[model samples]
Target: MIRVHIARQFDVRAADGRRLNAEELHAEGERLMQSLLDLEQCNDDFCDSVTATDADKGTVLVELLISDETETGAFEKSRTIVRTAIHAIGGATPWEASADLGADYRPRDVQLEYV
Candidate 1:
């Protein structure tokens, strides 16, 4: 089995020093995560989970758990799902509002087989 952990982050502030409600933001994050799962076939052998936490410095961390039967297409599927979910959420690319969901980390070359 392959278990992938993705962290999507959102900044709670605007340029004017305004802040977003944490509860509401977290809910939206959760919804986006669910949307990603729903993008896949229901019968697919994947176990998904989500978590939202505070960075203690005014940012929110959205963590995703993707447990799949194998490593094939895992990275691509994740990108596709997340990209679609972002469009559904705000009519814009998710990258516009959040940091790299995975940052500089990627699956080990041996464990991930795209083909």
Candidate 2:
């Protein structure tokens, strides 16, 4: 099994310059989770038991477990999948809008385990 920890940061705001409410943030997290789940279902090497958890500052941490039979470069493939999803939610260039790049919660601390 291969496991990876992925984190994505979200902003509490909409495109219209309005602050997002708690409900909206929660919805976004769920939306992201569903997107990941969708990806997992489409890949035979992906594990069925993926997990998503809401984190502080409108961020979500996802736990991805893949089967050992997956091909090489699995890490890069998984990273791209998540980065693309985050960019999609953030309008392709969310970091450009914020002076502090960290505000966008770019994915970080990718811990990989193979067993």
Candidate 3:
């Protein structure tokens, strides 16, 4: 089995073009983390664990551990799972996400925009 570490950073923003206050930001971060955790529960075949390491300054940091037969499969699966979690949250617009895979692989950057 291949173990891959994925870190995703999300720049969360309100739909009305206003910055979210600290309280709102924290709530949003929690929601996002919960969404990921929920997904992890269903995707046991590939996802090993999901963690919300930080949520502050209009950004949410999520770390994911995925195991698969190949590195490419793990990376792609991680991206799909994260995108699904983001979409599941809903309401948050113009979300931007970038990811860093662990040391052996080059970082895979992804941008997500909700219309």
Candidate 4:
């Protein structure tokens, strides 16, 4: 299991180029997050649970908890899936997102064997 944190600030505007009010802006963020969770499939296991919070004016903080039984590298794969989903919802690429496994931090090399 792994956790990913993604935060983004949006410029909420309507078709008439009018800024959305606090309620409208919040609703838009909620709608976007729901859309992301509704995707059937993208890369690997989709996020099992997600939390979206209005950090501040036009800013939303999205935290995703991802887990998969089929894929060992679920963390990496899920990150890619999240990015794609965000883009689909008109969200900016989460280039600053962070993902970590548990608390220990270590770099390891991997070797794949195929026969």
What are the Cα lDDT values of the candidates? 0.47, 0.52, 0.57, 0.45
Which is the leading candidate under lDDT? 3
**TM-score of predicted structure 3:** 0.67
- lDDT tens string, model 3, 1-115? 7666766665555654456667776776677678877887777754544434233455655567777777677767777776666667763323343232111111234432211
lDDT of 1 by residue, 1-115 (tens): 6766655555544333445356655565566566656654553533453535353444544344455665545555555555566556542342453342321111121223221
Q: Which of candidates 1 and 4 is the stronger one according to lDDT?
A: 1
The weakest ten consecutive residues by lDDT in model 4 span 101-110
What's the TM for model 4?
0.44
Q: List the residue pairs that clash in candidate 2.
A: none
* 1 or 3, greater by TM-score: 3
Tens digits of lDDT, candidate 2, 35-83? 6677776777555434343434544555565554343466666666665
lDDT of 3 at 88: 77
